[model samples]
Target: MQITVNAQPHEITSNTLDAALIELGFASPAVATAVNGAFVARGKRAETPLAEGDRLEVLAPMQGG
Candidate 1:
């Protein structure tokens, strides 16, 4: 399947957000995930399926306030 990450297109075979995280080399789900301009809650990643043209934004904690 094809999806856009931060506006860049990429081909991935993940059906779920968790799988997408792993495929994207994200070490863990302690961060945040946004799909297609919507904020995907932490508990919903497993059930949040991704589709073609979907946008995925993964964000992690930064050491700055």
Candidate 2:
């Protein structure tokens, strides 16, 4: 399916958010996610189903001083 990640379109095979993360090589869900402008919790992404044309925004903590 085709989806947008951070305003960039990407092609993926997984149907769920967890699967998508795995496919993208993310080892953990220590970050927040937004689907089509809606917030998707890390704990809920595993069960959260996604569809085509959906936009996902993944936000992770970054170190700064």
Candidate 3:
């Protein structure tokens, strides 16, 4: 399926958010995810379904002074 990740186009075979994150090499537990402008909790990633043209935003925490 084709979806947009962080405003970039990508082709992935994952059906769930969790799978997609793993497929994209974003396996860190500290990362945050949002699908189509809605936040998806860590515990719910496994049940959150993804579709073509969907927008996935992945953000990793950054520490700064």
Instruction: Using TM-score, give the best candidate's number.
Output: 3
Measured by TM-score, how close is model 1 to the native structure?
A: 0.88
Report residue 56 deviation for candidate 1 (angstroms): 0.5
* Model 3: per-residue Cα lDDT over 1-65, one tens digit each: 99999999999999999999999999899999999999999999999999999999999999998
Q: Whole-model Cα lDDT per candidate?
A: 0.88, 0.85, 0.98
Point out where model 3 deviates above 4 Å.
none
Estimated TM-score per prediction? 0.88, 0.89, 0.98
User: Which of the two candidates, 1 or 2, achieves a greater TM-score against the reference?
Assistant: 2
Q: Pull out the clashing pairs in model 1.
A: none
Better structure of 2 and 3 per TM-score:
3
In model 1, the worst 10-residue window by lDDT is 24-33
What candidate 2 gets wrong by more than 4 Å, as runs, is: none
Per-residue C-alpha lDDT of model 1 across residues 1-63, encoded as one tens digit per residue: 999887888899999988888898886767888998899998888899999889998888889
**Runs in model 1 lying further than 4 Å from the true structure:** none
Model 3, global lDDT: 0.98
